[model samples]
Target: MNNIEFKHLILTAKYFTKYEPIIDTKTDDIYAYEALSKFEIDNNLISTEDIFRHLHHNNKLFFELEKRNKQLQFESFTENKKLFLNFDADIFVSCEQQSYWELFLNNKKDDIVVEITENGSDDETSANIMRNFSSWLNNKNIETALDDFGQDGSMFSFYMMNGSKYIKIDKSFLRQIELNYNYMHYLKGILTTIRLNGQKSIIEGIETQRDYDLVKELGCDYMQGYFFEELMIIK
Candidate 1:
């Protein structure tokens, strides 16, 4: 409920938070678990979207909830699978958030991918800051992945950013590619370009056998969606 205290909600999230597995299509191995926030309240499962929608009016509470999510995930993370955490590019500019993130990197120097989600904009300032922070994280063995590539204008702006080691192709681009010849070729070109750049590609939304085979042809480094849904390895 909107009336619930932020602290209490955070406590509630710890018991309900889950991680969804993202697989390596080439190896059939568990590459990482993308942390997803959830809370069971009153016999109903509350998702991260639901919590944020209700807390939209409260900025302080929103920030606190995010911090708690990271803390809980970090404390429980194992070494076997990489921990994938998503945040906007601007979040790293915060002194508090940066300190917290750095502490996590210090403890777990491997298998952590900080996914930069769709931020408000991709101006020089935010883009440059993220690039620099990504470099810092690289030196610490904490990799950065550009999430939702080409989903929107702001996200598309990040498509050419050379700092990321991993790039997640937006699902929208692949939704109808298998059915359209032109779309298929276009996607093939994109994947080829990514490979040429020496960055691994994670093609999202591979829901069918055709999709999987298609990406395999394109040399997709990773794949996720309903096709691999049954392969949930996060437990």
Candidate 2:
């Protein structure tokens, strides 16, 4: 099926689900929101990477899909909670100011966090756009996060310079902490740098006791993944 057809099929399917907020134990606050999409056939979830790949290849199709997804999320969450909506940096950068910010303000300024995927845009242009977008959000007192930081060199640099209030470590890095000492050390240094710069570090993909222990030891500011709670459908 074509990209449009595929997105339409997924959106129309009744099996898609969204998870509840993942709270930070240390702060007792909801830190991140994850959206889980399930297929009706076998009750399988589509990976975040797959979703972004489809969006990258089919921009118009993804735009329409996201428009609907954002509306659903806005309807589901209360104004006291922040909704973490993942989107391509390019899509976010190109979003129409009135439509995007208006929807967010409708929910309240503090109740939205836009998590920009790490690999969504090319380096030079992406950096500039992210800087501009970050500044805009800062002006409006809206929170911005560099999602999946440490997945690549570009993402690391973007987090350091963009002045994002939160940095979400990629799940791949957390998954291998036990088997790879070097990687664990590398993540520690990254987390330290994030904290040193006055930003919060969120460890993603915590599916095991080891993952939880490591993040707790490192004093990660926030946590997300199956270990805490599976994504739940609000309805």
Candidate 3:
């Protein structure tokens, strides 16, 4: 999509936020909610990945749309639980933009966690951008999470891994565990390391009672997926 076409779609699209609850394993209660963006245009839903892939061509436009999305997410969230807001590393384009977001998130540090997401770009440049942005978020006293840690094209930065307050294991790990018991061993090791570092581990894609039971036994600090609750529209 060209800039003009993208802009037109942005203006015409019906954008909303859906929240998926992150559950604390011990309490089996809601720990936080991750704000997921949904976009529908002309009665057809567009995948978030597709929207982001197109927006990657324009950093300024990406930031603008995300700014609005954040607003909607924040406004629509009524629960006192912490909210996980996805922040693309590429959107930190300028000092001016940083200043804008600084002011925007000034009072929300205590209640927000900026999840660092690397979609299509996960090269050295993208990793560097995320590292710097992660530092900035840390400085602002906002919690940060390394999203999709083991996904393809998602760079594993030790700096980011150690610094993040939360490390979310991707859904694929669950599938792998089911296929091979060795994968379960690997997950246990990962979870062990995460706990040793004093960081919490959140396992994603717990879609069944068996999945929940298995993940719970693995000692993940939190769990998120359809097994707990389906994504609920924010408004």
lDDT of 3 by residue, 110-195 (tens): 88998988856767777788889988888888889999989866687899998799999999998987888789988999999999
lDDT of 1 by residue, 1-235 (tens): 4456555855664345466677687886778777766766556777766766666556456667777777777666655778888864444566786787688667765667888764455677666766667666767677778887767575354433466788888777777664566787888787887889998889887788887787777778888777777755342
On TM-score, the candidate that comes out on top is: 3
Give the 10-residue window scoring lowest on summed lDDT in candidate 2: 35-44
Candidate 2 per-residue C-alpha lDDT over 1-235 given as tens digits, one digit per residue, 9 for 90 to 100: 6765677675775544466566685874665566554445235556546666756756566666666666665676653556777655555555574367556555655667766555556577677766666666677677777777756454446443456778888888875766777787888888888889898888888788877777888887988877766444444
Clashing pairs in 2: 19-232
For model 2, state the Cα shift of residue 38 in Å.
4.5
Residue 49, model 1, lDDT: 65
lDDT of each: 0.70, 0.66, 0.85
Between candidates 2 and 3, name the one with more favorable TM-score. Answer: 3
Give the C-alpha miss distance for residue 64 in model 1, angstroms. 1.8
TM-score of each: 0.80, 0.78, 0.95
> Which has the better lDDT: candidate 2, or candidate 3?
3
Find the candidate with the highest lDDT and give its number: 3
